[model samples]
Target: MILTKQHLQNNFAKARETNSPYVFVGIKAEGVSEVIVIPKKSFDAKEQFYMNAYSEDLTHVMNNNVMITGLSYGDADQIPNII
Candidate 1:
């Protein structure tokens, strides 16, 4: 089944409940955008690891990254970055 934004919203809702990381791959113009929705507890470790690993020539690309939060199930229309 195709995963729509609604599916993503539901998944994130559940993740928020269990405090788990919600990861999803979305297509973007530049490349594949990997969205990892982690609660505050998990974000710190993930942030450190990604920052270290991606802290090379990808500084510019990473700096342009757009993060979205508090999106409702129907707010997929708001995410123009998601294709």
Candidate 2:
């Protein structure tokens, strides 16, 4: 069977109905079959901020319960890596 964009959409629709945090999908192309799945990981607040509503102002994060820790940037080159 040939996989089309509709197939992918159907897969996503089915995934959304399930309670699993990750979705797995398989596709066949060029006589090869491959499986794809989203990896389930602990929710990171920083990622949510960056992906959903990231802003340089950071006023929202400053005022929200976003759990900001390990903020130790005192010098120009002392910026720490955010999770």
- The candidate that wins on TM-score is 2
Query: Which candidate's lDDT is highest?
Result: 1
Compared with the true structure, model 2 gives a TM-score of 0.33
lDDT of 2 by residue, 1-83 (tens): 33333443443444345533543433233444444334334223323433344223222233343321212112223232211
Q: lDDT of candidate 2 vs native?
A: 0.34
User: lDDT of each structure?
Assistant: 0.39, 0.34
Q: List where candidate 1 sits over 4 angstroms from the true fold.
A: 21-27, 32-38, 41-83
lDDT of 1 by residue, 8-81 (tens): 44545554565554333243224445433444455446444544533232233354353222222122342343
Residue 5, candidate 1: Cα error in Å is 1.9
Any idea what lDDT model 1 has? 0.39
Instruction: Give me the runs in candidate 2 sitting further than 4 Å from their true place.
Output: 27-34, 40-83
For model 2, what is the alpha-carbon lDDT of residue 57? 24
TM-score, candidate number 1? 0.31
Q: What TM-score does each of the candidates earn? A: 0.31, 0.33
Clashes of each: 0, 0
